[model samples]
Target: MTQRTNVVVIGGGQAGLAAGYHLRRLGIEHVILDAQAAPGGAWQHTWDSLRLFSPAQYSSLPGRLMPSQEGELYPDAAHVVGYLADYEKRYELPVQRGVRVSAVHRDGAQLRVEGDADDWRARAVVSSTGTWTRPFIPAVSGRREFTGRQLHTVQYQAPAEFTGQRVVVVGGGNSGAHIAADLAHAGVDLTWVTQRPPRYLADDIDGRALFDVATARRRALEAGHTDTGGVASLGDIVAIPPVRAARDAGLLRAKPMFTRLTTTGVEWADGTRADVDAVIWCTGFRPALAPFASLRLRATWGHIATAGTRALDEPRLHLLGYGDWTGPAPATLIGVGRRPARETARQIRELLA
Candidate 1:
């Protein structure tokens, strides 16, 4: 027998929790399904040195403030994970951990979610399965021929492991920059490679600044204004203290993208070859929507086409926290995700009412 609910949230991460929080407020019958044994969603998978670009206050969900260490501003991954677990407990939100949803499909007017151990029939589904599990490593010729160790940030733990080794860190995103810096500080000979120049905001600009201008950025796009010279992109690199210190020590510098992987290291576009011990790829990720492959609504960009977080082709489905393509800064910790989560719950509540 399939259990029935008004809504089924597809993840237990921040996006899923936010959806559950709002649904509970409306007295809606819903359940958030998490595959992990514990709370923390993607936070549990982040490297130990990773910290939120925003302060605790700026990283909060709707009903609670994320607490950090007494003197600390940005909370680390563990703190955020603990807060999320506590938030679920505090609200008594119906979350069933260890239940990995394998498929979601149309079942009359309700959607059926099949799990490894059971199944659920719900009026609507909110998918917030984030991208951490699907790390991106660009294909370079001879990458398979390289004899050295290669890892993405997904598998990275402490920088202590790469001590005294020559390393090449690829990509210029936040993860790439921090991982490269950490490896460099750990006595590793490091070279940073990027396809383009990395953008670094002023020290004063943090995640808060990015959140503050999200609305303006949305409006500007709606007005068809193309010249967005001064606006800060949500994904633009922030000048955190560690990165700043790395810059001061001249460790956080960039090299142009290399053309191919060599037996030992990489071959640059200029035909120069370098010998390195390992290469850490931090190219980022795509959405984790493989479970809904049967839905057949995914666009060519590997995302389900959505109208305000609502899947355009499937009205009962909503995709959250994938990235800006879904909604402005929905993937961020203290970003503009809450509003969409709240709105998603409200819309589903009305539809199922």
Candidate 2:
């Protein structure tokens, strides 16, 4: 038997919680399916040292603000996880943990969401499963021949794991820079490998600035104004404390990505080889859209067509926290990530009302 609801939300992380919050406010009956046993979304799985690039005030959901601790510049992962748990409880968002949703399909005008042990039939579905679970690792030649240990940032907990080991940190994002910096400070022989030179924002710039820029761009587009161009991307690594310290110490140096993986380490494009013990890929992740594959909604350039958080091709189908396409700043905690869910909920309510 399949239970039904007004809406079904996939994921219980920041995006899911935001969606659940909005739906609850709209008096919409909804169920949030969470794969994690706990309330926090992907924050629970982040490395122990992971901290938000933005301040606590900036990194909040739709309702309550994320409280910061005394003398804390950026809140750590545990703080975020704890905050999310408290947020859900505070709002009394209905969340079912430990339920892994396999797929969602269109059953007439409604959505049928199938999970491990439960199935939900809902008029609408909000897919908030962010990209944390599916960490991307670039395919390099001779990848299988590498004798050294390899792990993605998804599996990285602490730099101490590679203590005394020569490690190559791959990717040009904040995670790569942070991990490489942490490893260097942890006494690990580390090399930073990037496809392109990692871009760094000004010393004063951080996640908040990134969000501001993105929001401005969105507002410009919405207002039918021509973009002046030269907007900086939020994807550029913010010079957080560790990264800044690493830069000041000249430990933030990065090398071009190697052409191929060698038996021991990696081979440069020039055919030069470096012996190493491990490689930590912080490449990037694809959106966790697998659970919604059956919807058959079209995607162009890896994004589901959306009109302000509402699916352009499918009624009552919305994606949150996937990326900028879903919303102005859907992926960031401090950014306008909460906007998509609120807008989606509003639209669904208007349609159903």
lDDT of 2 at 73: 87
Query: How do all models score by TM-score?
Result: 0.96, 0.96
lDDT of 2 by residue, 220-297 (tens): 888999873323543468889988998899887899989999899889979899999999999989888887667778
Candidate 1 Cα deviation (angstroms), residue 41: 0.8
- Candidate 2: which stretches are off by over 4 Å? 228-235, 336-338
What does the lDDT read for residue 56 in candidate 2?
Answer: 92
- For candidate 1, the TM-score is 0.96
Model 2, residue pairs in steric clash: none
Candidate 1 off by > 4 Å: 222-235
Task: State, as a TM-score between 0 and 1, how close model 2 is to the true structure.
Answer: 0.96
Clashing pairs in 1: none
lDDT of 1 by residue, 1-353 (tens): 58888889999999998888888999998999999899989899888888888889889988988876676777788889999899889989899999989999898888999998889998899998999888888889999999999998899898788887888999887788888888877878899998888777777887787766775666677689873533354445777888878977998889999999989889988899999999999999988998888888858679788888899888999998877666667888655345778778888877886
| lDDT score for residue 298 of model 1 | 59
